[model samples]
Target: QTDHYNLLKRSGRAKATTESEDKFLRVNSLRDRWLIEQQLQAQLNTGRSQQVSVSTVKRRLRAAGLTGRVTKKRLVWATKHRQWTTEDWKTVLWTDEIFGSSYRVFHSLQTWFVASTVSSLGL
Candidate 1:
């Protein structure tokens, strides 16, 4: 009898990226969470004739459990202190060392923030 399962398994086309390329993409993505798929694709395409699509880059990233999220706007502290005078500023405590995490979100015609996960970044 002819085996149908083996025949069925061999039907689809090969993936665009190889194992090494996928690993490179994942490592770069983890290293720089803000990198977009287009940029990643461009980097991957450099020095190679075979170019991968942005969607393919996105798919590879998604497979590695990375997703894009929009960063929420924080309350503007400067606005609250806008009316404060020199005397008011002197009354506040000043610290030479700052202890807090900071992540800058750049905005342009479109905004996209990429992170491994919401829980990972504690967002």
Candidate 2:
């Protein structure tokens, strides 16, 4: 429930020779928190204003205690260890045989095929 701009403004409002440094850290922390909640994969730097290099960004994020926060996401089907064995895919099947070229296309179809077939048998 922290107000980012307000927090930064308050922190930067501190009397210091280098108030910008404080402001940058505050802003960067806010950005990092936002990126975390949004589940973004990129690491954010408090020092970069489109002027900082990638290496500098990495350093800044590390300095901010955010290095461990950098994470990579897995695919929907990916396993925990990322190593897949044949047994893991035993439930899967691939059929090269084609059923037919085409089947009847039904529109708004709602026939009780099972009941009708049963009744047709006169049982």
Candidate 3:
């Protein structure tokens, strides 16, 4: 962004919109920010880039819609059952439901139920 742009040290003349700037650096990980800044500084030395800095690299990453966040993790409940007396069970419906996951990068989501109501599902 303009903020990062102002922080860069200008030194070259190569200013192509589709230059290697977009390809050579991508903030895909935590170390990527520093590494990208180092690489871009090297490019400036060889005149491949006009201005570059850590801030500029981060700005480019942000502009490219790249963001960082802690991954979500949770424990999945497995085979756990509740015990109830016959009189109590008479007022409750007992069943087991089976489900599968949905699309897009490994999610712990339960999609449509593949089986419902143990008896009808023949489980």
Candidate 4:
């Protein structure tokens, strides 16, 4: 008789999330890019006695190719510059590069973004 079993068919525990749940995660993640894993887990665990852990939510998001990042705040234009007339602005030269000493500021707020969006945002 031929052997019916194959070594490639290794068995293990199934995934905690279903296809629909994964879809829901992806949709909501895309809709709100700033939601943290804890927040996402709370949303998914609403009305359930057994709640999913934050790690699971994170793993699921990572599997979906989404990652968390710290969003950088853009430099705000000075109030004095807002009142500048076209003629006044003409005196200043605008270029992509900063010419003098500059300070870099970063915010600690955490947010999530897809891999493609992260690259596009230059984060």
**lDDT per model vs. reference:** 0.71, 0.38, 0.44, 0.70
Q: Once superposed on the true structure, which residue ranges of model 3 sit more than 4 Å away at CA?
A: 1-19, 27-49, 71-123
* Per-residue error (Å), model 1, residue 103: 11
Q: Write the per-residue lDDT of candidate 4 for residues 1-123, one digit (tens) a residue.
A: 587865785589777777788778888988976566767888888876777888888888888877764243222344446688989988988777655432322233345666676776788
lDDT score of residue 77 within candidate 3: 19
Candidate topping lDDT: 1
Model 2 residue pairs with clashes: none
Candidate 3: TM-score? Answer: 0.28
Models, CA RMSD each: 7.3, 22.3, 16.9, 9.9
Could you give the candidate ranking by lDDT, starting with the highest?
1, 4, 3, 2
- The better candidate by TM-score, 3 or 4, is 4
Which pairs of residues have clashing backbones in candidate 3?
Answer: none
lDDT of 1 by residue, 21-120 (tens): 9999988887876666778899999988888999998888778766654333323454567799999989988878565443544441112344556887
Whole-structure CA lDDT of model 4: 0.70
Q: Which regions in candidate 1 have their CA more than 4 angstroms from the true location?
A: 1-9, 70-105, 108-123
lDDT of 2 at 105: 34
Q: Taking the candidates one at a time, how many backbone clashes does each contain?
A: 0, 0, 0, 0
Per-model TM-score on C-alpha atoms: 0.54, 0.26, 0.28, 0.53
Which regions of candidate 4 fall more than 4 Å away from where they truly are?
Answer: 1-10, 70-108, 117-123
Ranking 2 against 3 by lDDT, winner: 3
